[model samples]
Each structure stands twice: as structure tokens, then as C-alpha cells.
Target: MELLKKDNYYHIYNREINSETVFQDANNMSYFLKLVEKYLIPKVNILAYCLLNNHFHFAIEVTADTKDVNQAFSNLFNAYTKAYNKQNSRTGALFERPFKKKTG
Candidate 1:
């Protein structure tokens, strides 16, 4: 589990279970990016990121008086899941966990 305190940076990674292709093509990846910009970038600081077929990596920072990182993550994940499910006609969890966050 990740404990997000104030003024800290974390290395975060999330993977699709069973190594399924969460992002099948460039268009899917683009859609995910659109959702991130629409919902995530405005809320938190995303220092670095790399998106792959079944997972992604992120280096991010949180404010000192932060309240909920989970909510922010959920918005992005749920939005992507909804879009992916609608596009691919599938239903299930997109990520394996609550997103691993290591503070540094």
C-alpha cells in the first residue's frame, strides 16, 4: 500500500493482470492520454511517465496538505476502463493493484 504524505515524490507503477494488453494500439494510448489530461494533470504533478502494452510507470509528487491520491488515480483508471471496455467489449479490472508508490 502507498502512504502519500506531503512534499514527497513517488515512483508509481500499475500493471494489467495476466499481462493482458491494456493498450492495444496507438489510438487506445492516445485516448488514455486524453483522459489523463482531462482528469489527472490538473489535480496532481506528473513528473515522468511511460505507457506500455500492459502497464505504466510514473514519477509524481504530491502536495504536503494532500487529501486523496486514490480518488485521482481512480478517475483515470475508471475512465480508461470505461473507454476500453466500450471499445473492446470487455469487462474486468484494468490494473492489478492500487498502483504501487514508492516514496523518495
Candidate 2:
């Protein structure tokens, strides 16, 4: 249960492969925000963030057990992929990785 210990913050991100556009337009950004708003809001406290063309940056505090982060991030990432696929009419992953974590 050591990973469950509530002791650090994490900055996590993933990029589109080959430096492609992740946020093709404003709606993509909007969709990502909505996903974060709905899923990551309760479990994680976001300190800062920036969404660029092909990647995103987030500074967040995990107030509870660290085990919860993967699920929280998965929800956000899945939402993004669904939106991206629907918008772009393509399939497969949007992110290079599903989840990445760091201790802070």
C-alpha cells in the first residue's frame, strides 16, 4: 500500500506521436477541459495547466491514495480519444502513453 500513501504531487503528460496536432481546433481543447472537469475534478486538485497543439502540461496534487491517479487519468484520456476520434474521423490512440506519473 506504499503507492497508496498520500505524499506527493505529480506532473503527467503524453504527446501525439510524430509531433502531430493533438488539439486541431478549439473544440478539441474544450473537450479536454470538459473531460478534466468531469473526471479529475474530485480526486485530483490541479495546480496549473497548459494545452498546446500536440501536448499538454499539468501540475496536480493527489490528495488521496496514489492508486487512484491511473483511473482518473484513464477517464480523462479515454474521453479525449473518443472526442478526437469523432472529430477527426480516425481510430486508435491519441496519446503516446495512457498515463505517466511523477512524485513531487
Candidate 3:
């Protein structure tokens, strides 16, 4: 239902649950970016980005190879969340379920 179609442009964003701090420190940001590079850089053409304490945004163009863009993003978020929870000793969801995106 929330597929990111190929050949489309999207503005993507998500926030931590309840506006909780997602990036508690610089390492968290670095890890998230690394995950993004690992999962998303291969699939889409990233135009711009903004990373904050509790949220992040990306403007990207889906490439032909991005057939499973949403899954790739999910992997990125899940990986980040797992590591974050282990690092911070927290539980439950970190980001709000189902990230937001809009074609543009």
C-alpha cells in the first residue's frame, strides 16, 4: 500500500515516537547516515537531506533499480532502531510506524 514507485520523486520524512530524541549523540547520527548510505544510496538519487535530533528528511528521486525502495528504507530504519535500542537500553518502537512520503 505504501510503495515508493520508480521514476518518481518523493519527499520523505519520519520522526521518533512522541518526539523523543532519536539521535542522542553524534554516533547515532553517524550510524543512521551510514545505514542510509548502505541501504538507500544504491537505490535512489538523493537530492537533499536534513537530520535533526528527533527526525530526518530526504528528498530523493527513485531510480529504475529502486523497485523495493520502501523495503530498503524500512531496512534502514529497522537497522537503526535495533542499534539505537541496544545502545540506549530502550524498548518498543522508535520511529512512528510507517514513514511519511509524498510524490513531488
Candidate 4:
């Protein structure tokens, strides 16, 4: 994982493990965004976002020089994964190993 630089834009993305559906229903999408707002909104400014069945993407700009940027993302995914696992009655990794990012 790369350290997110302040004032830089990035294209961030991740996919569900084994191409399984990450969002089972509309409520799952809402819950995922709520988690994003809780954990990532303070760390980055979201420029755009798209959520599909098995993956999601985000265009964002880092707003500050904070060491917790990566941790915020980890927290966001972990929280969502936990809720998703519990709700779906499944276990193990929910997403791919490391989320991907690119300068944009």
C-alpha cells in the first residue's frame, strides 16, 4: 500500500474475493457508503464513486497529511466486511488482498 499524499488525486478500487457479490441488496450499498462517510470522509475528499456487484471504485483527493489515511481505509473495509459477513452468515476474507490505487 502506498502512502496517500496530501492534495493528490487517486483512483482507488477493490473487488470482492473470487468475484462474489459484494453487495447483496440495496441496503448493503447504503451501509457501505455510510461506513465510507464514517471512516474516509475525514481523510479524503471524494470526487466520484461507483459501486457494482463485485467491485467498487473511487476517485478522491487526499485532504490532509495524515498518517491515518491507510488506517482509515482499513477500518472502513474491516467494518464493512464484518457487517457483511454477519449479515450474510459467511466468513473469511471478503475482498482481495490489497486494494489498488493509481494517480489520476
Candidate 5:
């Protein structure tokens, strides 16, 4: 996991474990976005985003650039995964790994 730098733009992404569907329905997508808004919006300025069946992408600019940024991402995924697992009656990891990021 790379630490986000202040004022830096980045492309961040993640995929579902085993190439499985992450957003099974419209409600799932909405919930995931809500989690993003809650946890990521404060840390980065979102430029663009795409949420597919098994993966998600984000174009963003770092805002605060604190170490807590990673924790925010972790919280976002953890919360979403927990909700998804409970809703779908499944358990274990949701994402393939910690999200990957690149300068863009």
C-alpha cells in the first residue's frame, strides 16, 4: 500500500476475490458508494470512478494526505465487506488485497 501524497493525483483500484461479483445488485453498488463517501471523500477529491461487477476504479487527488488515509480505505472496504457478507450470507475476504494505486 502506497501512502497518498498531498496534492497528488492517483488512480486507485481493487478487484473482488477470485474474480467474483462485488456488486450483485443496485443496492450493493449504492451501499459501496455510500461507504466511499463516508470514508474516502474526506481524504481525496474524487475525479472519476467506475464500479464493475468484480472490480472498481477511482481517479482522485489527495487532500489531507495523512497516514490515516490508508486506514480510511481499510475502513471503507471492511464496512462494505461486512455488509456484503451479511446480505449475501457469505464470509471471508471480499477484495483481492489492499487496493493498488498509481500516479496518473
Candidate 6:
């Protein structure tokens, strides 16, 4: 994905590792959204979101460019995966690597 330059828009989505459900409950989903708010909201304006049983999506408009925008997203996913794993007694990657993205 591009660095999410200011004023550009992007749609980002990712699925769970294997076919496992990433969001097993409401709290799990809420926590993931919280991670997004905590991490990516600083870098972009969240326009929409879709949280499913095994995958998730986000639409964002970049507010500015600093370092790599992907890092902000990476931080969001990594933080969520860490907490989800600990809470679920699982030990491995949660979302698929290199989450997908598209420009519009």
C-alpha cells in the first residue's frame, strides 16, 4: 500500500490466520476497534468499518504523512493479535500477513 499520503483514501481489510474466527465475541470485536482507535486514528480519519466473525475491514482517509502509514496499521493488528491470543489461550498469528489494501 502507499504511505497513505494526506487527503488520499484507502480501504484496508484482513482475514484471520487459517479459517479460524478472529472475533469470537463482542468483547473481542470491541477490543479490536479500540486498538484501531488507539493506533490508526492518529494517522487517518476512519470513515467506516466492518467487523465480521473471521475478518475485518476499514475505510480511512489519510490526514497526514509522517513515517510509514502501514506501521500504524501494523501496530493496530499486532496489538490486537497479542491481546486476543492471550485472552483466548491461543499462540500464533491471528490475521493474515500483509493485510490487503486498495486506493480510491
**Best TM-score among the predictions, by candidate number:** 4
Q: Quantify all predictions' global Cα lDDT against the true fold.
A: 0.80, 0.78, 0.89, 0.92, 0.90, 0.84
List clashing residue pairs in candidate 3: none
Error of 5 at 72 (Å): 0.8
Once superposed on the true structure, which residue ranges of model 4 sit more than 4 Å away at CA?
Answer: none
Candidate 1 regions off by >4 Å?
none
TM-score of each: 0.87, 0.85, 0.93, 0.95, 0.94, 0.90
Evaluated at residue 79, the lDDT of candidate 6 is: 94
Q: Indicate whether candidate 1 or candidate 3 has the larger lDDT.
A: 3
Model 3 clash count equals 0
Backbone clash tally (model 1): 1
Total clashes in model 4, counting residue pairs 3 or more apart in sequence or in different chains: 0
Total backbone collisions for each predicted model? 1, 0, 0, 0, 0, 0
Clashing pairs in 6: none
Q: Encode model 3's per-residue lDDT on 1-104: one tens digit a residue.
A: 56888999999999999898999889889989999999998889999999999999999999845557778988998999899999889887899988998889
lDDT string for model 4 (21-82, tens) is: 99988999999999999999999999999999999999999986758888898899999999
Per-residue lDDT value at 21 in model 3 = 93
Please give the distance, in angstroms, between residue 42's alpha carbon in candidate 6 and its true position after superposition: 1.1
The candidates, ranked best first by TM-score, are 4, 5, 3, 6, 1, 2
Ranking by lDDT: 4, 5, 3, 6, 1, 2
Q: What is the lDDT of residue 15 in candidate 2?
A: 87
Tens-place lDDT digits, model 5, residues 1-104: 55778888899999998898999988899999999999999988999999999999999998885677777888999999999999989999999786889997
Superposed model 6: Cα runs more than 4 Å off = 66-68
In Å, residue 3's CA in model 2 sits off its true spot by 6.4
